[model samples]
Target: MTQVRFMNWYLKIAIGSAIIGGGMEFFMINTSFYDKVTVLEAEKGAYENSPQSQAMREALNPWRNKDTEATKTP
Candidate 1:
């Protein structure tokens, strides 16, 4: 009966430690992912506001200026 009690205690400790370790790992991974996403968002915002992005937009939409021309009195 004593051996059985000891075994039960050992199993409980093992399971508890495993759960704690998994929780720590999950927290670390989520923190890392959040940091990465933040950095990427900042970089994306910077790129979108740059001249290169504006030039690309103009190049992609060549007819963007035609509306003003069409409304002009000739």
Candidate 2:
């Protein structure tokens, strides 16, 4: 009887851990934390290597370099 109760407890804990882990993984991958980590990694990469970061920097930079054509005077 004791052995059976222990097994049940173990099974419940294992299942609960699995469910929580799955949820955490889903949240981490689908939420802003993932993007934040990716951005940090990209920034680190950009600091270590220039060429690898150029596109990422352009994508994140506020003051971009793209030119706009002149408009007609009103």
Candidate 3:
């Protein structure tokens, strides 16, 4: 009788944990967290593809030749 009682308790805990975990995981992944990440990635890609981003990159390049700088004429 004691063995059966322990087995029942174990089975109940296991099944309850599985159900609760499945629900929690479903909510977590379906939240705005994923939406925000996707939006952030899209904005990042758009900025990277913009001409302004390329100009900023060139202006910030350390290895660029001094002759190419806009402050001075050839």
Candidate 4:
């Protein structure tokens, strides 16, 4: 009888742990925050690819030490 009670307790614990683990995994898989993150990243990429972005990049190229005088002789 004591063995039966022990087996029942073990079964309950196993089932409970399984439920908790599955719930956390399901929540992670169904979350929507990743969608919003991806959308924002795509928008930023698009803006960086625009003509104004190209011009700004070109203007900043000089400051990036593109001039021959800025090159290290080493």
Candidate 5:
């Protein structure tokens, strides 16, 4: 015997709506905040081992006290 469909019309519509909503968010055309972060990280590497880079990092992350190199040390 064949089994009948468990999902009803409302359920399917709800699932479809949820999928489209999620897709809209996931496939957004806008550049995200993390994209800016990745670009800033690349810039950080561009200024490697420099006082300017240290100053920029400090200005960016004021909550943190020490720089990466300094924190890496004992």
Candidate 6:
């Protein structure tokens, strides 16, 4: 009877530890995901505001405004 009681206690402790460990792992993974997303967002903003982006936009402006220029010419 005492051995059975000890086994029950050990099982409870093991289950409780598993639950706590899973919760901690879930929190860490979510935190890491958000941190990576934030870094990617900042990098995207930097790339969009860079000189190369401006030059590309300028280079493509003629094609983007092609219809407007055609209408004005006639």
On TM-score, the candidate that comes out on top is 2
Instruction: Give one digit per residue, the lDDT tens place, for model 5 in 1-74.
Output: 12335456667889999999987877654547568878899887878778887888789999785576687998
RMSD after Cα superposition, model 5? 8.0
TM-score of 2: 0.51
RMSD of each: 10.9, 12.2, 9.7, 8.1, 8.0, 10.9
Model 5 accuracy (lDDT, Cα):
0.77
lDDT of 2 at 57: 75
- lDDT string for model 6 (6-56, tens) is 999999999999999999989979779778888999999999999999889
Deviation from native of the Cα of residue 62 in model 2, angstroms:
38
The CA root-mean-square deviation of candidate 3, after full C-alpha superposition on the true structure, stands at 9.7
- Candidate 1, residues 1-74, lDDT tens digits: the string is 99999999999999999999999989978779778888999999999999999999999999998998999957
Q: What TM-score, computed on C-alpha atoms, does each candidate reach? A: 0.50, 0.51, 0.46, 0.42, 0.31, 0.44
Estimate the lDDT of model 4.
0.86
What value does the lDDT take at residue 71 in candidate 4? 73
User: Model 6 reaches what TM-score against the true structure?
Assistant: 0.44
lDDT of 4 by residue, 1-74 (tens): 99999999999999999999999878866897567789999999999999999889888785665455557654
Runs with alpha carbons beyond 4 Å of true place in candidate 1:
1-31, 68-74
Show model 2 residue runs off by greater than 4 Å: 45-74
Q: Whole-model Cα lDDT per candidate?
A: 0.94, 0.81, 0.89, 0.86, 0.77, 0.92
lDDT of 2 by residue, 23-59 (tens): 9999888887888998999888768677656767777
Superior by TM-score: candidate 3 or candidate 5:
3
Candidates 3 and 4 compared: the better one by lDDT is: 3
User: Model 5: residues >4 Å from true position, as ranges?
Assistant: 1-7, 33-74
